[model samples]
Target: MFSDRFDQLVQALRILPSVGPKSAQRMALHMIMKNREGAIGLAQALTEATDHIHECTICHSLTEDDVCHICSSHERDDELLCVVESPADVMAIEQSGSFRGKYHVLGGHLSPLDGIGPEEIGIPYLIQRLSQGKVKEVILATNATVEGQATAHYLVEASKHLPLHITRIAQGVPQGGELEYVDSHTLSQAVHNRMRMK
Candidate 1:
């Protein structure tokens, strides 16, 4: 129905997550017809970001420099290291304002079925970093999924020799969640990890 260039633009837009053919077509039309300047700016920004952004050498988080701002900041506690699965997780933790510790992004969790293992997610490097004795505590903040739990357990086993105090992030019902709506696994975890309040 449209020109080759328009179809190409729609296809390009469809590359974004959750965007289908119709949505991509709508986006393409909106960009070309209503938001040409905004579209151009978006294109330039995407190009610049892709060119500049890279993994931080220290923690494997996304950054424009060798080390991310969080890893380089002296204000954060060096003794507390939070291990996460991705840069997005790091962003989530930062937004929560609950933690003031260093981070280690594993890039991904263990998935043996997908051939992802310890080496693939830089587990060895994490152990090496922990072995240096700078971090007194290591918080396993990976997702609560099976893969994430396995990765956390593997890290615990690997670092058993070290004198570090390792802990997993609590998993359970959300702040506004009701018991009836929660899943069995989550409810079980909530019960098992119940805190004693005096």
Candidate 2:
């Protein structure tokens, strides 16, 4: 219904997650008609980012350098390592302003059905890093999904022989969530993890 370039742009925009054909078409039209300058900047930024950004050699987080800022920061606790599923998780944790340690990104969780295993996610390499004896404690910050739990369990089993202390992040209801609206499993977990006020 549009020019070849316009159709191609719409198609490309549709490749973004959760973007439908109509939304993609709207975005293409808006960019071309109202935001051509911003669109050019966006295109240039995407090109530059794709050309320079890469996985950090130490933590596997996205960085323009060989090692990410988090990994290279001497102020961060090297003895306390937080293991996460992805760079996005790392970003979330960083924004929380709570944790003050280094991180090890797993790249992904273990999904047997999907053929994602320990080696596929570089779990063995994680174990190797833990075995270096510098890190004393590891906090598992993977998501609370079944696959995430399975991956955490696998890590626990794999590191059983090591002297490092392993801990899973507590799961419970969100801060503003009401009990009636919360799922039974999360409520149960919240009850189970309830703290004493004495």
Candidate 3:
């Protein structure tokens, strides 16, 4: 068994997603014994990031600024809006460099049992934005999961009268797959081959 501080470090490391107790302990040991400087840098970066990072006002994506670059950019297509479940999905799509449109991050998908509903994930705000009529196309880029599909369908129904073209990314993303884990080429192709849902 290690000291209290070491145990605390391991516990803290375990706070990261998918990090188990053994992995946390190993990471703690590596940070303390082999990469103390690197660990310190990582700690500072995390602290600074947490201190500054906040959601973009327009798209609900993580950004240090009030508005994300994509939302504010003039070169990006203002008529095309890609709706994603999380900021990670936004990052994945951006990394793919396929879609030249703006984005609307839903924050999360619909989960009735979990009590996550339309208002809970900023769907009303999305409808408001769409109602403004700046965006002509709405790409339902939510993950391929059941909840994601439900959310997309709900959005389609919710904004049926908005007079905007609603489309869904191609099925190349695989069934029940999250966007963040999908490969760039696959994401690109999916965006390219998107089908109209409305």
Q: Using lDDT as the measure, name the better of candidate 2 and candidate 3.
A: 2
| Residue pairs of candidate 1 with colliding backbone atoms | none
- lDDT values for all models: 0.94, 0.95, 0.93
Q: List the residue pairs that clash in candidate 2.
A: none
The TM-score of predicted model 2 comes to 0.98
What is candidate 2's CA lDDT for residue 120?
A: 99
State candidate 3's TM-score: 0.85
Backbone clash tally (model 3): 0
**TM-scores vs. true structure, each candidate:** 0.98, 0.98, 0.85
Q: Score candidate 2 by lDDT.
A: 0.95
lDDT of 3 by residue, 44-160 (tens): 999999999999999999889999898899999999999999999999999989899999999999998999988899888999999998899999999988899899999999999
Model 3 ranges with Cα > 4 A deviation: 172-198
* Superior by lDDT: candidate 1 or candidate 2: 2
Estimate, for each residue in 43-111, the C-alpha lDDT of model 1 and write its tens digit.
999999999999999999999999999999999999999999999999999999999999999999999
